[model samples]
Target: MIAIGFEGSANKIGVGIIKHTPDGKVEVLANVRHTYITPPGQGFLPRDTAVHHRAHVIPLTKQALEKASLKPSDVDCICFTKGPGMGAPLVSVAIAARTLSLLWGKPLVAVNHCIGHIEMGRMITGAKNPVVLYVSGGNTQVIAYAEHRYRIFGETIDIAVGNCLDRFARILNLPNDPSPGYNIEQGAKRGKKFFELPYAVKGMDVSFSGILSYIETLSTTHLKTGKCTAEDLCFSLQETVFAMLVEITERAMAHIGSSEVLIVGGVGCNERLQDMMGKMVAQRGGYLFATDERFCIDNGLMIAQAGILMFKTGHVTPLEDTWCTQRYRTDEVLVTWR
Candidate 1:
């Protein structure tokens, strides 16, 4: 069976086609993504981001289909990221998916954004029942499979880790060509000093709002006094925050008694973060699983891969129930496929 997935939950618009065989093999026929990059020192607005998705969805869908060497009629299902994202962007992509479903007479599947990341990670890495650390601009959670559902072990109490990094990048007027986080990572590579920053990790949950606030103040002070370079700030921020993430991940791994760790979501692509996590898992004599930017970052393939699993289990979203939301929790979805 072939599935076409659409993803525009945030600033990225992606289209992917996947083919699943009866023997339980999955092939990524095509996975195309285009990001809506804003100017330096600026963040994306929902309205404008929605417009970007609306304008690019058709072209991206066409490219994906072409790359897959399949037509819309050949697709068995249309899958899309339905919630836990920017409302406008989600709706824009949903409209496209709904239209395609109607136009091609295919089934529609509404996928949770977070679950898509997890499922894709599992599929790509073949990490069966491992502790998952999902981090993105809007979300940060440590999850594990239990009782036929992906349960949250821990999450952010305030702003997400990726949001903190992006906001800090804005303060530094970093280029958003690839991504704010990517630029921050590059700057961090040049850093030599380690500045003391607040590290907030309370039990299983973590908080980044206080850390972000403190970092912003430090950035302003540095601008006036030149006491610290931007590279050092980036380095310190990454070290402090990623260490907190690794600490919580280790705690979760210990609690679950599972040595395997899988990191998903956009922030999962950071090399430094991965290095930190790898060391932590290695110290425990465990293994760490991670995917490259194509699968780690927001993409239609993950959505398609996850949606196909739901479709195979006889799940379908009716047109009337296709309204998009911005707060769909990961643990809310029932794991029928598992």
Candidate 2:
């Protein structure tokens, strides 16, 4: 069976085609992505991101098909991210998926964004039942599979880690060419000093708003007196926040008795974050599993992967139920395939 997935939950619009063989092997036929980057010190608005996705969805789908050397008739299902993202962008992609499902007479599967990330990570790394640290611009969670569901062990009570980094990048007027977090990572490599920042971790949940607020004040001070460089702030922010993340992940691992750790989502692409996680997992006598940019960041492959699993289990979203939401929790969906 072949599945084409659409992902436009945020600034990136991606289309991917995947084939599942009779022997239960999965092949990624094609994965094409385009990002909508805003100017320096500016963030992408929902309306503009939706417009970008609407304009590129068709062409990207065609490109994916062409790259996969397949026709529309070869596809068995249409899968799309349905929630836990910007509502406008999610709806734009869902509308496109609905149109394709209707035109091709294929089944439609609405996938939760966070579940997509976890499933894709598992597929890529082959980590069976590992503790998952899902961190992105919009989400941060420590999850484990229990009782036929991916249960959340810890999450952000305030802003996400990536959001804190992106806002701090705006404070420094960093270029958004690839991403704010990527720029921050690059700048942090050049840093030579470390500045103290607030570290807030309450039980299993973490908070970044206070850290962001403290960093912003430090940035203001730097702008006034030039006491600290942008690189230092980026380095300090990454170190502090990443430490909090590693702490929570370690706590979850200890509690769940799982030594294996799987990192997913856009922020999971950061080398520093991965290194931190690697160290923590190593101390527990386990390994860390992470994917490259293709699967780490938002993409259609993950959506297709999760969607195909659902479709095979007799799951399909009706037209009336194809609406997108901005707060779809990961644990809300039942993992029938597992």
Candidate 3:
């Protein structure tokens, strides 16, 4: 089946086309991502993001279709992110999917942004039952699949990991809209020592709000005292947060008897996190899989891959289920595959 996917959940705009044959694995015919950092003054431009989707995704969609040797009419389904993202951007992608589905007489599949991440991780890593660590701006959770369903073992009690980084960036007057993680990574690289930051761990569930608060206080107090550089603070912050994740992931792995570790979502692209998790997984003789930014940072290909799986299993959303919301539980959707 031929499918087209639209992703505008965040600052990035992406369009991907792919097809799967009964006897062969799914193939990515074309995958393209357009990013808008939105400069330093603005946090995020809602109108600009939508315009970006309209201007970039439409053209890229056409190109992807052509590259796949198919016309828009040949597409069997149009997949789009349904929720757990900025409403403005999701609206843009949803509208685009609706228009295309209507124009081409194809099914519109409302793919959950988080599910897309997990699906893409599974497809890329070939992990049947791996421990999943999902870290992104809008989400932070450790997951596993059992009894044909994805289950959340642990998650953020308050702010997400990426949001913590973004808020820290905002305080430092650094660019945040595209990715605060990148700037923090660079800042950490320039750092000389490991400073102390809050490590808030309440059992398996982690809380980043405390970490954000602690970091902000550190920056303010250090500035008043004239003692530390932003680079040191950034390094310390990443170390504290990533250490928390590594600890929790290791605990989850031990609890669930899972040796394979798969990291997904936007924050999964962080090289430091990957290295940390890689070390922990290796010590236990486990395999670690992290998607590259091409797939890790959110894109249409993951959604398309998810749609194909849902289609194969006859799991579909009715037009009534087409409605989008900023909040939806992963467990709310009935699981048909592990």
Candidate 4:
């Protein structure tokens, strides 16, 4: 099956094309993305991001098809992220997908954004039924597949880790061109000292709002006093938060009796987090799976991968039901194929 996907749930807009073969082989024909970057200390607003998506979705789609060396007639279905994202940005991409569906006369498959991340992570890492640690700008959860759903074992009680990192970057006036988190990671590499930050882990859940607030004040006071550099703060924050994530993930693994862990989402691209996770997994004599920025960050190909799986199972979204939402849950979709 050939699927073309559109994703614009956040500041980035992406278009990707992929094919699933009869022999169960998957091929990524094209994956193209464009990000809407804001100035330092500024977060991307939904309105501006929606405008960015509207401006680039068409060109990116064309680029994807051209890279795939295929026409619209060759695509089997039109796939799009249906929800759990910024409302206006989600709607902007959905409108494009809907129009393409109508124009190309292809069936529509609405995929849950979180499912896209999980499915793509599984496929990329070839980790069979591993504990999943999904960390993105908007979400943070430890999950496992059970029965017909991906059950959430643990999650952030307040803001997500990525949000915390991004907000911290804003406080430091770091550049957001590639991503504020990436810039923070670079600074973290130069950090030689680690400051103790609040580590909040409540059973299987975690919290970051307090940590972010605390660090923000520390950055303000310490930077002015020349007591701590930005790198020190970044390093400290990464270590503290990643340790929290690793702790919860390890707890989830112990509960589920799983030896393998797969990391997915935008924040998963951070090498520091991956390193910390690897150490914990190694100590447990288990394996850790992770992807680089190309797959880890929000992109359309992951949506295509999950959408094709749904389409293969005879799933289709009626035109009337092709709506976008901002609060879809990970366990909401029934995993019939699994």
What C-alpha lDDT does candidate 4 achieve relative to the native structure? 0.95
Q: Model 1: per-residue lDDT, tens digit, 155-224?
A: 9999999999999999999999899999999999999889899989999999999999998999899857
lDDT of each: 0.95, 0.94, 0.84, 0.95
Give candidate 1's TM-score: 0.99
lDDT of 3 by residue, 203-300 (tens): 98999998888889988999568688988888999999999999989999999899999999988999989999999999999999988988999899
Cα error of candidate 3 at position 5, Å: 1.1
Clash pairs for candidate 2: none
Model 4 stretches with alpha carbons more than 4 Å out: none
Q: Which 10 successive residues of model 1 have the least lDDT summed?
A: 219-228
Per-model clash counts, in order, read 0, 0, 0, 0
Model 2 regions lying over 4 Å from their true place: none
Could you tell me how far off, in angstroms, the CA of residue 268 lies in candidate 4 after the best superposition? Answer: 0.4
Q: Give the per-residue lDDT digits (tens) of candidate 2, residues 133-226.
A: 9999999999999987999999999899989999989989999989999999999999888998888999999999999999899889885798
- Residues 1-338, candidate 4: write the lDDT tens digits: 89999999999999988899999999999999999998898999999999999999999999999999999999999999998999999999999999999999999999999999998999888999999999999999999999999999999999999999999999999999899999999999999888899999999999999999999999989999999999999999999999999999999999999999999999999998999999999999999999998899999999999999999999999999999999999999999779
- The RMSD (Cα, Å) of candidate 2 is 0.7
What TM-score goes with each of the models? 0.99, 0.99, 0.94, 0.99
Ranking by lDDT: 4, 1, 2, 3
